[model samples]
Target: MDVPAGVLGRLRGICLGLPEAYEEVAWVGVRWRVRTRTFAHVLTVEGGRPAAFARAAGTEGPCTILTFRSEGPELDVLRRSGPPFFGPPWGPEVVGMVLGPNIDWNEVAELITESFCARAPMTLTRQVERPPG
Candidate 1:
């Protein structure tokens, strides 16, 4: 299944809003990156094509998955949330979120921002105006 246009548009806005962030077509899907480091990636997982992602999402059917960098308490919280949230088979800091109806766009934006910060250099990350926790 293709990723919804609205969801991609929203992700584009959030990621491109960051300093020095750029979007590109990744091997399987689209990814937003800071320099050479990928901060966020969105792709369709189906038929266990990408076995790791399929296993991570716990599904063989089609699903839109967004993977991003996250850490600390926020990462821990998401990992415990289940379903829409899961641990992608990547680095320690990588988190996978299943996109669908009833998604919290505000939360998605925040997570993308955090993902940017995680991958961006201090020079660029300093430019982001993150909300108070």
Candidate 2:
């Protein structure tokens, strides 16, 4: 299904709030990047691709999900948390969660920030963590 405008809008607000974050669409989905490194993206489970994730994220049809660059343990926590959140088909260090009404916006924002910090360069990370006086 079409990604709700509000869902993407809110996510954009959160991710782009970080240092040097930008958005782009590619083969995978809408990726939020720090320079050239992707810290997060949306997942679209197209037919015949990502079979396992399509089943897990309930995206067998047209659906959009917010995926993040995170650690394996964190992904496992999200997997156990249930609906609107799960691990992607590939990448043990990646986590994805369906963007839907059930999600708490604040939590999503926090997750996005954490994901950005995880992938952003140390230079940018330091700036975000400690702005110039």
Predict model 1's lDDT versus the native: 0.88
Please provide, for model 2 over 1-133, each residue's C-alpha lDDT reduced to its tens digit, 9 standing for 90 to 100: 3356777788788888899999888565578999888888875666735576587676675666777877647767886677777766677767778766577887787788778878888888776642222
Worst 10-residue stretch by lDDT in candidate 2? 124-133
How far out, in Å, is residue 76 in model 1? 2.1
Q: Ten-residue segment with the worst summed lDDT in candidate 1?
A: 1-10
Q: Residue by residue across 1-133, what tens digits does model 1's lDDT show?
A: 6667888898999999999889999988799999999999998888886788899889885888999999889988887789889987667789999997899999899898998998899999899999779
* Candidate 2 Cα lDDT to native: 0.74
Best by lDDT: 1
